[model samples]
Target chain A: MKIAFTTKGREWQSEMEPRFGRTDYILIYDEDKDTLIIFDNCEAKSHEHGAGPTVAKILIENGVNVLITGNGPGGNAIEVLKKSSIEVYSGAIEMSVKEAYDKYKNKKLPRF
Target chain B: MKIAIASGKGGTGKTTLSVNLASLLAQKNSVFLVDLDVEEPNAKLFLAGELLSEEPKYKMIPKWSEESCTFCQKCVEVCNYHALLGIANEILVFPNLCHSCYACSELCPTQSLPMFAQKMGTARHYVMPDMELIEGELDLGEEQAVSLISQTKTYVDKLLLKDTIAIYDCPPGTSCPVIEAVKDVDFVILVTEPTPFGLNDLKLAVETMRVLKKPFGVVVNRYDAQDDRVFAYCESENIEILAKIPNDKALAVLYSKGALIYHSSKSVKCELEKISCFLKSLTCKERA
Candidate 1:
């Protein structure tokens, strides 16, 4: 699985790689299994004043399969993501990357 | 014209300067004091006001139908965000995970997907005797503060009944929220203190402002007893120094008690008045 995660804040960089607790969003690809591995989108950058669209735009362009993070997306932004195949998990901020990914694997997390 | 007061790091007296400056500006021009720091809105604490109205808003997510889903896995394949989960017999939809692109619905051969709206947050607007205060409160545990701030601005535009100036207290950091608050503004006031952390964050904020192509000046908070490094940096960068508020323990004591420092100290008020004048002149020059 090829997984990419965005750091939440600079301070959490050290802990993010080891446990998946630091980054704001995690994108995972399960190639051989033929199953998509998704985490959450928690990238802290989107919290900026005018950055919702910009961040969502980047995630879609990058081909992120699953974004495990904490953020309630904007209205128009939701439309853009639905078109782009990017899913956002808004209440995943407090959940560690591992926990979020595990839930996705088990189909325990509810859809927004 | 609208002016945003921002600090890169937290606890840098942004609210203090914003409140005083807005009060002073309100004396001559009707000023709208907007608290863009939705996460921790503190401007109303200094200004006396009552809740006027709050409107709830939301973002949309896609709803999928499993009855017609053929398990082609196309939706899953196309979804880079993994918002859709397709099983042999069922397809699950995660609304919080949905960015609302409608790609799944667009790509679905059976057209089994549709969009549904969900609450995002509430923006509160309060009317004070002298000025209006507006705040965007993202629902607790919500992540998209930037969007709420953008919506709040439109609401503010509707409330502008006459010609008035605006003083926006922007959030900390140089990320999306900060950019949204400062964007399209006439000018920005970057507030900082005299410390290593202060200087570092100031640089980040300044870089962000430059990237956004906004005219900005520096205001050194707590200048009476600090090193000259901040001043030196401003001089080298040719960034204009707006005004400096001295570090007064008396003022600090007043602030600790939930009172505005500017009201307790005439010197502080005078300093902010000077800054207000400087800002007006610069804005005039920019307009010319």
Candidate 2:
């Protein structure tokens, strides 16, 4: 399964970003292979409107099955992700991507 | 000739200037005053005229026929607004998110998606003996402001007489709605106040008008010579200062009572007449 975390920086040690759509980077972790892929979310930065669904589409195309972030996705993004059966978990603020993944694995994060 | 009255900041008296200028110009020429501030239209409050007609405006949105849809997701791919979602063997449509571009139906291979019009707002027509007012009012929670503005302009275009002067009372800010209101006009009158905020927004509005390549002049509303920033900027830019309306308590009281200050105040009437004369000179030049 592929899990994605919204992060302020590209590395795994970077703190989790509170925003889902406008986050600076996205850290995707492959749970089966134990590998991580960092994606720069610079395209969404200049979006004046509809950034949420645009970011959600990017994550969906990347084969992300789960999303772990500090804040909840917007209403439009939630609708898109829910339609694709992607699970979204919250409560990752101030934590690293690894820590957020671990919390999700242990069922400690709240589902939004 | 068409003139658009615009301001980058809200409450800078765009409507006040629009109504007064239109009233002054209508004394001799045929004038059509269009209130394009669909979100919060207040020009109607000050203009007293018999309501002639109200026509609802509609925008075309796509509707899919489930039985004929092959679930190819072509419409979803073409939809830039994310209004269409293709789920497990089914497609979902969000009407509010649609921009009425009709791209989805155009791209549908099977032609299952059909186009339909949705009611967005109303265009109202009010007429006095000399001047006519056409205003667009968007329905609450509707997001298609540009479409309604364009529709109102189209309606006014058909009714306009030859050599008539049309004045558009535009909305605030240099956003899409403001562009729609001011685009393709003969001239733009930028109404601004005398303050730091006013100067900043005036710069923005000037930049927008420059990009639009329209002839524009500045009007300093509530002008106080004590704060010379507005005048200084206009002088440095070499832009024309058409008129200066002095800040007065009586003007505020009259505005609050939805009254036209030109009707009771001689000084304001003279200033607006000066603006009307300037605009008339432009029209004369255009004719010559």
TM-scores, all models, native as reference: 0.69, 0.86
- Supply the TM-score for candidate 1: 0.69
DockQ of 1: 0.05
Off by over 4 Å in 2: A1-3, A29-35, A44-48, A58-66, A85-112, B66-97, B128-130
Predicted candidate 2 versus true structure: per-residue lDDT over A30-96, tens digit per residue: 8899888988888866666556776787787789899999888988778767767788998899888
Per-residue lDDT tens digits of candidate 1, residues B65-180?
76887788788667755566553245656555565577888888988776777787888988888888898887887776777788888888887754588888999999878999
What is candidate 2's CA lDDT for residue A108? 96
Q: Provide fnat values for all models in the order shown.
A: 0.00, 0.07
Best by TM-score: 2
DockQ of each: 0.05, 0.24
lDDT of 1 at A59: 60
Which candidate comes out best when scored by lDDT? Answer: 2
